[model samples]
Target: MPLLDPALWSGKASIGTWTPPTGGTAPVVEPATGDVLDVIGVATAEDVQVAAGRAARAQPAWARLPYTERAAVLRRAGDLFTEHAEEIRQWLIREAGSIPGKASFETVTAAQECYEAAALVSRPLGEVLPSAEPRLSLARRVPAGVVGVIAPFNVPLVLGIRSVAPALALGNAVLLKPDLRTAVSGGVAVMRVFEEAGLPEDVLHLLPGGAATGAALVSAPQVRVISFTGSTAAGRKVGAAAAEHLKRAHLELGGNSALIVLPDADLERAASTAAWGSFFHQGQVCMTTGRHLVHASIADEYVERLAHKAAQLPVGNPDKEEVALGPVIDAGQRDKIHALVTASVDGGARLAAGGTYRDLFYRPTVLTGVTDASPAYAEEVFGPVAPVRTFTDLDEAVALASATPYGLSLGILTADVMRGLELAERIPTGLVHINDQTVNDEAVAPFGGVAGSGTGARFGGAANIEAFTETRWITARSAQAPYPF
Candidate 1:
């Protein structure tokens, strides 16, 4: 699919006569060649208001539909996603700089989520509670009106679509604000699915643009809920804006996840899993294992194995079938990674391997001898940099992992099942994986974080449905009984 073809898509600003943003459209460059893939329209605040209003108007009828009808729509959308997978995958590679394999995985995963959501919505809301008097006390999940979805550029399709699916499945209309960088690809994919599913035209509106558009969406009174996934700073702003209007907000923000390697663990497996988790999507994932806490006895062996694996990762064009690692999202992110690494080195952390930045592509970096004083140990380095630290025992490892204010996800690798179970209970993070890397995310599990990581949970089947809906209880006393209060 050609990027930025005025004929292909109606821009967020207006229907026809759609022009690219006049602020000299920034190039969405392919990370490998620095080639301009497309120019996305930077939407203004007015554009977002229009979209939000449209969605709010369309929500009532959608919410009134039967659960089975909503399920059918979702199923059809999933089928359409499968049919157009190839086209969407290509766009993902070009715009988001995701390797062919990873891009394909993301597209397929999103499609699967649609199908799963359909099944979830089709089930009964809740069973009637048994009561002494003849009364109907049943909990029913009802849509929370129009939900504003602000998606991040990294893992655009999967993370972006996740917010929409559960909300839409529960009969909530959505105003999807995709990141300008990957809007063409992500927006097109969503539009195609909804169109093919025969959903109401205004049920889901795509508002593609930058920060200004997002602010407008959050501020609009029509938006009942705000679902956001991005940087901690941006998330805070969105949350505050939503709070101003007393609107419901769900946020999946930044994380500096840790992977703990116990003394009795298999070094090779832990090393391999950690490498994949830390470098996947150039380590831009909120759940990616950016921190490593290894037992002192096995720290050297684990670090050496991890370095060897990192060195072998195939870094090249995202469109290439064999490429394993792709570029950071843009040059700005590249500079940020460089600055963090330099500071870490200056703070006395030893560079274990791969710490250099080249234009948009940063090498898969690993740092050791990191102290709490260093930013590398404390901050969320959303890059392909893994900071390793040593721990004398399990308590120490757990303590170090919990030191950071953010508690999103953490992984523990060990052979002792008892120890793993015990550690899992003590970890402060929301999700903990034993004998695996932190990247192990199941579609059905409750995926989210605690503390600064953000609020609310996604996935976990029925739990997700409840998150997008509000409950109301009804009582009838036959109109004959006097006031019992």
Candidate 2:
């Protein structure tokens, strides 16, 4: 099937276009070559209200349908995703600055999520309750009415569809506010997929814009839940606003994850994992291993091998087939990554490998001698920069891993799998990987973080459906009895 037109994404509902405020249009640029791909109109606060109202009106009929019907639609959507994976991959590369591998991975993951979400439709919503008396009590899960989804720019297709597929499968109407930059490909493509797959026209709405649009979507009273994935700082505002409105808010936020290499780890395996974890997608992933904590016995050799591997990956336009690490999403992000590297080096951290950039394309960088006092150790660079540190003992290693406020994900590389599992339990992250890289996600896995990283709402399988629904307790009397008020 042919993809939808980009021009169709202008502050629209399923059927008609909403009038945008006098907000000026913004140009969507290809990060690698600094080329303007398209100019998109901004969605105003009014647009959010209109979309949310439409979703609220449409949700009841959708929720009333038998789950099998919903499952059928979702299955077809998944098939559509498989059919157009290559086309979708191209969009991710051009608009999201994703390298070929990363783009392909996202497209496949999205297709998987659609199929995985189909199973959620038939999963038991509530269990039979034990009755205490003649009265029968029961509980069942129902749609939250309208779920407002605000997705980030990085990994937009996977992250955006992650929420939308589940919300729709559970019969909640979705109002998706994709990042302004990826409005056409991420937002419109999703809308078209479901519409073409026989979904109800008003059940899913897409409105694309920047911060004002997102805020409006969050604050709308008609929206029963807000599923947001982005920076921790922005997530706080969304969570707080949802709380104030007494709405259910599910947030999958930032991660300053750590990758730990024990003394017994295979040097070659650890080095390759570290390079892939830190430099993939230029390290913009929430689960990217931001810090590398290695044992003192293997720190020097591991860092050297990691640095050597980082130097070999090609950094260029994602449009090219050979490029492994492309540019950061924009110049501002590039500057921020460069600033963190500069500050870390000036503060006495040793630069072991690449530490420079040409335009938005930053070379994969490796640093050693970084201490807790260094900004690179404390903040999330969200770039292709890895800061390595050595620890003398397991307790110290655990401490270093748990030092960050963000507890999204962690990785441990060790030949001793039992020891790694024991350490994984001690870490305060939501997800842990043994003998693998930190960046891992599947449609069936429960994916989210705790503490500063997120609101403890996982975004796959049953967890996703739960996030977009509410529970109602119903009671009935088998026989009429004298009741006092």
Candidate 3:
């Protein structure tokens, strides 16, 4: 597939060409091959302010349209995704280091998000409240004007559209700041989709830049709600800035999620799930199983099987048909993961299989004897590495899993499905999977995390629409009643 032209985004940002106040242009590097894919102009604070102002002006007219009319445009955009899936897949592989399978999944899921968000037009926003007197009282949901979406590099396209589609569906204009690494496909490509789908210009603005641009968006008075997905450290700044400015901020942050295996669980299936969960997309996913807590009775055999599975999976160029794991985002990320793995092994975490990298391609690594204090066991490695531990008691396993500051997602594998469900409830994370891995998501499900993972503001279903809207209470009287005012 040929690389997309950078001219695709030229003059497409808020109202006109988005000239950066400084910092010129940045190269988008292909991590797998270290290729200079293209260059994108960086947006500045001045550009962010201009985009937010345009979005604010465009939003009220959009909100006044019947939801069905708005849904039509979004539904067309959804259809366009399926029609252009292959091209999007190619871009994802080149720009984001997504294997073919992962790229396909993201593109299809993103399309599904657009389709589902269209249905949100019919979803009830507010309920009628019963009154003691003969007055009628009810609440109506209204758009929060302009929504600011700051998405991360990993899974940039889907995560960007996840907020953008729903915000537009709920009658709000959007100011989107996609990750600098994925500006071309994730940000500019999406803008084209909406534009060709007949969405009015200025309703959706794409500003691609770094932290300064994001900070400007968060602090913009015209931007009423801010929805962000990225690292916890970045999210903290975005959240605090939005709060200081009194903007509604909804964040989907980092995670160090876990997958637990009970003694009676299917070892073969559990091993397969573990390998896939820990290494898919080079484990860049927020819900990737960073830690594995297995029953002591079966830990040895399970780890052995998992190691075998990890070793056999192909790890190479994301463009290949058979490669299961791809490169991390960049050399810095690869070095970070490598350093963490090296430190963990030095700290007594047994390297059961694969602890090496060739350029950006890191092997699928599995470790045992990882103690609670090990960095591999504690932090979000965000790489294709799995660190397993043994636990005799379920309560102990739950406590150990919840020890991290993140509460994003959890997975439990057990023969007893009912017991897994019970344990799922006891888990502190916002999402839990029974007899499955931690890295699972659907377009229609309520997706988010709790605690350090996120703000508990889910991104799908009716909650998606609610996140971009505000509720207003209104009352009507059949007849004027004497009041002491």
Candidate 4:
């Protein structure tokens, strides 16, 4: 298949594409082959203003439409996405370097999000509260007007759609700024679906560019809400910019999540889940489990199991179905991962498996005997590296798990139900998985982090809808009593 032409995709819409700022066009490269996929047009401050103006004009009409009618449009979009899943999957593989399986899963996840949002919108926002007097009181959940969505490159389809679907379903207009790396693939695929479903051109806009474009969207006065998913440092900057305008912002930032393996846990299962979570997407996920805290009684055995499993993951072209692992997003990320591993090794951590970077592909790495002071344990190693530490008991394990500044997601592998529940309550993260790894993300569950991990929530059905909306209280009394105020 030929690479998608941005001009052609934008031409399909009535509103048309925003032209690049002077001398601002940049190449979008495929990580695997180092090939230039396309030259994406960058947006300027004026471009953001124009997009926001168009959204403001279209939002009221969209909000006025009945929930069922709005849902129908989204449902049609889901169908369109399913029809073109393969093409989108290939694009994701080339641009984002997502393995074939992961790419396909992302597309499916995006489609499922659209269908789920449609179903959620059909239900009433709130129920009436009974009152002693002959009056009515109810809560109405309403949109927050124009929203700015700044999505990350990793898991672009899933993360971006998860935010955009709910915002649109709740009757808000969205101006999306996808990461410059995978903009053509993820951005164009989503815009095509929404446009084909008869979404008003003004209601949805795709502004593809680099940091300047993102800053423009966050700093725009007309943007009422900003939803961002990226590093903690970048999230802080975006948060500060949004605060200047006093716009509501939702951030899903960095995570150095830990996976705890208890004494009674199944070693095989823990090993497999740990390998999958740490290596999947080359550890680019914010919620990827980078730290493993295992009970000392079984720590050595579990580390050996993880090493064996890590060696089995095939590192090759993302387009190959059998390739379990692929390259990191780019060479810069590869270098970062490499440096972290080198520092860990120098700090007395034992390298149990892979630790070398071949171009964009970093070998699946496994480390043991790491300390809390080591960077690998303290920071978010966003690569295919797993650092393991030993704990004598549950209390020690919990302490190690909570040591990091991030509290996004964590996992505990234990057969005992009571122990699992106890740990789940004590853990500070937003989501906890029992008998699994940190990579487990469900569309129906509330998936956001606590502390530096993030603020606000995504998924968990109605909670997501609530995140994209504001609540208003409506109270009614007899008309004769209206003068009392």
Candidate 5:
């Protein structure tokens, strides 16, 4: 069949095994135009149970395959993603509200992630260790059986694949639960790639539904690990539920990240960076620069320049116009973003640029004169809103940045790279950029956050060794000699 032909998926539930859904069906609506794209089944708790059982049964043989054979499958999957990039790009634009550039980027990144995961298979998996007794000892890495991946709507393709590809590459079966709004791009597309790449039947299950499905996946007895990417509030619940089952949950959660511009930095360059960091993908990113901390001496010029950049960028339906930003996921998200802006303005922050939206198309907004009391300044807006604050010195900048419980990503721009590095040490964030924006990702870099942002279960390169695998100690003796008895 053609890639993601609407008729092919209509009334079907999963990308694996072609089983009918037990939780009924949901219409796939395009948020930008309010058009029903297709109809897909919504999986229920019972479906999760069945998927878990299938995964448990299928995992052993898959794991027993030769490492080279497994790696070859992943390599083929990567190539398939590139070969079908245009088709995947279209789905991302229509289903996830991604701009053309963003859609293209996702396809490239998805292929890169799969390639990286392919390489992971041949990496040194175990190490020899010293033993006191006359025996050979070793420490080995093994897959956590039946991994459960729960991904979000924003950046669906990258977020889902980052976990799914690596977990499967490590010889674990996966049960993925993607948010309903962008299920086709996030869940179904992934299933198709692995399926065509020749993954064994029942090794991966795609469950698309609401909270009930996610909860079922998290708490399933057969699910040994959970990989979740979403809000902090929901992440906390996932963590708790997984703990109740004594399983680990890898969480890459929310953030109200900051971008600090020192007085010595280039104003024009800094302004451009700030605008991209806060407004790219409509600021619906975990590492979005929610707070802009500029030195007081250069704050006015920076705000003015940043506001101009935000205003110059166009916003509309990506399918129709050439725009820098497209509509958010839905109406509820738009309302929440506007309400935060209104609260920030009511609390004394000045609207430096945009503060209005049409339907789901929220304008890129900038704010000045913000304080700790401003809601948008203090909260994770998850919209195209940038709230700026002025700091007199490095001490005040550090103080302001550290005030939030979130410690995800921090960016600092300055002429003196050494001083920027020095300042970064004082902050508690997981990732830092000396002279770049906060919204950055690579298939090779270890990406995640700290504190409320997540459990610090990073995904990428060598980090995957720890995220998806468990360490075991094994010993071999020449013979079974004498016992105490």
Candidate 6:
């Protein structure tokens, strides 16, 4: 079955179906071949207001619904992801510029998140505290009423659903604003899954739109919490707007994450890890290894291995061929990635492997002899480009990794795992993996960035609680206590 029915935008709907979006239309294009996949509704600022209104009305009832029933619905949602994994995978590949494996990963992530969110309903929601007076005192978590979720195009299914499912499960309504470019996989598909799983009417609204729509959602008086995942620049605006409105904004922003290779690390294994970290999903990831810090002893061999791996990996239309990487999202994104690489080369960073493109298919690139000033090395080059920079010693490695303002994910490869752990602590990062590469996540792990990255611990496990709910203190007594008159 098509995960998102085009009829959803028909300006009309039968009972128990999606409310027609209040926006214009845009064509969904496959980046690989420039094929118009489908025409989808584009939400406006007014559309966001409408969605927020509906969500506000629906939220109280959803919050009051029996927790078991809510959990059941979420479990069913999880099942749907698994049952329709193939169709979802196809949409992800075609619509989101994901390769088959990456598509599968997103589908699995969606399912896993649902299962984890369902479990949230069964967790203890309140705690008893000491009563100073003749009364019982308790602190309880209550849903933040209507949640506003603005998700990005890259890894849309997971990034959107991670917050969406948990907020709903925690007893809140959601107005989701996904980037119009990847609306089908990011917004409509996830909404469709919830609908099939029997989510209550008006509890979730999916609106695909541009920045103005997001601004509306952020400023809406009814939305109590905003979950935004995108660039650092946009995240700052979201955070500022949310603060002005006195609501919570959970932002997971950009990163130029690093992978450190120690001298003792096996060159072959470390290079393989580095290649996957940088090139996976065309390196359009928040935790993409933008800087490669390798000990000078093995730097030359590591560069050769990394470049060879990048060259050998097949890059093409994922749906048509078994390719390791797919096309970049569009010409603009492709050009931007290429510009960074070219600028780095111009600034004296040697191009070790790729610095070319065919249509939107930018080759996986590697750079050697890069300095901190290299644009591609310093910036979050969200493409299939890996820039290798050499560090002379442990102190130098620490300096190189700490050079950026971002503290998202950090990876260190070393034969001495304990030493790697010590090094990880010295460098500030929200997530770190010793003997591994930077890009990694699981549904159960707390995932967020810090410093220039974003608000820390905004999703997964206990972080979800903080993101989706508010703590309210309650006091009760068998008889009403009188205050002094």
Give the candidate number with the greatest TM-score: 5
Assess the local accuracy of residue 457 in candidate 2 as a C-alpha lDDT between 0 and 100. 51
Off by over 4 Å in 6: 9-20
Best by lDDT: 5
Give residue 239's lDDT in candidate 2 (0 to 100): 90
lDDT (C-alpha, whole model) for all candidates: 0.80, 0.86, 0.87, 0.83, 0.91, 0.89
Which model, 2 or 5, shows the larger lDDT? 5
Worst 10 residues of 5 by lDDT: 7-16
- List per-candidate RMSD values in Å: 2.7, 1.7, 1.9, 2.4, 0.9, 1.6
lDDT value for model 1? 0.80
Q: What is the lDDT of residue 160 in candidate 5?
A: 96
- lDDT of candidate 3 over 163-183, digit per residue (tens): 999999999999899898888
Residue-wise C-alpha lDDT for candidate 1, range 377-433, written one tens digit per residue: 789888899999999977887789889988888898889978887987888887888
Query: Each model's TM-score, in the order given?
Result: 0.93, 0.97, 0.96, 0.94, 0.99, 0.97
For every model shown, the clashing-pair count is 0, 0, 0, 1, 0, 0
Q: In candidate 3, which residue ranges exceed 4 Å CA deviation?
A: 1-5, 10-23, 479-485
Worst 10 residues of 1 by lDDT: 10-19
Q: Regarding lDDT, does 1 or 5 come out ahead?
A: 5
The lDDT, on a scale of 0 to 1, for candidate 3 is 0.87
Location of the lowest summed lDDT over 10 successive residues in candidate 4? 10-19
Between prediction 2 and prediction 6, the one with superior TM-score is 6
Candidate 5 matches the true fold with a TM-score of 0.99
Clashing pairs in 3: none
**Residue-level lDDT for 449 in candidate 2:** 95
